[model samples]
Target: MAIEHADVLRAAHLARLGIDDADATRYVGDLSRILEMVDALQGVDTEGVAPLAHPLDATQPLRADEAIEPDRREAFQACAPSVSQGYYLVPRVVE
Candidate 1:
């Protein structure tokens, strides 16, 4: 796929990016190369290949699911200026 100067300018305009003539020319070449590489990659045969979640075969060690801290909801709520039905109440700022 070839990336033209007009395509670069249109993309830049749509993305609200400021690109000068020199930069746009450079980007046209860069984008053309990228698209050509993508086209090349699309030609590869991988009919029997299974998708990989990770490249390396590794397992993450996980800690046991257990609570270590004591529940102190009432203790903390006692310091709040306003609390109702186990919920902190703040002054209404919106209509």
Candidate 2:
């Protein structure tokens, strides 16, 4: 799980990062420690632990999917500059 200088450079290149020699060396050490921590965590025993969708178990409230307003397409279209058969007309832009 040791991160090398080449690994750091490759990762930086893949991520589109512009890192100098000093920063790349620092990243190598940082990334190696992170991998070591992950490898250590993989050794933990959790056979009896149950997976949870959320930390808290509570139902989320939801509103009814019904409309609360009347349609006003005619009233709105009456104010438009140009409308025909309930459709707005715009000038042709493409040749």
Candidate 3:
């Protein structure tokens, strides 16, 4: 696909880029060549191949889920400056 210089300028405007006229001309040509390479890749054939996220088939070691004893809540609450109905009390921000 042939990309025009105007398209490059429009993309630069959308991206908030300030490209010099010299650079914008060069970028238009470079981007067009990149698109041609991507178009070439579309001609390749791949049959009977399973898609894979990784080349290796290894599993990570995991720890078993287990229940733990509750910690001392009363002991920790004793150090609070104010407590009401088993909850911490603070100065109200709203009326």
Highest TM-score model number: 2
lDDT of 2 at 7: 92
lDDT of 3 by residue, 1-95 (tens): 88998999999999999998899999998999999989896677757767767778977789779877688778879999998888888998696
Better of 2 and 3 by lDDT: 2
lDDT of 1 by residue, 1-95 (tens): 88899999999999999989999999999999999989997788979989778888997789898888898999999999999999899998797
Query: How would you order the candidates by lDDT, starting with the best?
Result: 1, 2, 3
Model 2 lDDT-worst window of ten: 51-60
Report, for every candidate in turn, its global Cα lDDT versus the true structure.
0.93, 0.90, 0.88
Off by over 4 Å in 2: 45-95
Please report the candidate that would top lDDT against the real structure. 1
Per-residue lDDT of 61-90 in model 2, one digit per residue for the tens? 999998998989998998899998888999
Clashes of each: 0, 0, 0
lDDT score at residue 34, model 3, on the 0-100 scale? 97
Q: State which candidate, 1 or 3, has the greater TM-score.
A: 1
**Model 1, residue pairs in steric clash:** none
Q: What is the C-alpha RMSD of each candidate to the true structure, in Å?
A: 9.8, 10.6, 12.3
Instruction: Give me the displacement of residue 52 in model 2, in angstroms.
Output: 10
Error of 2 at 22 (Å): 1.2
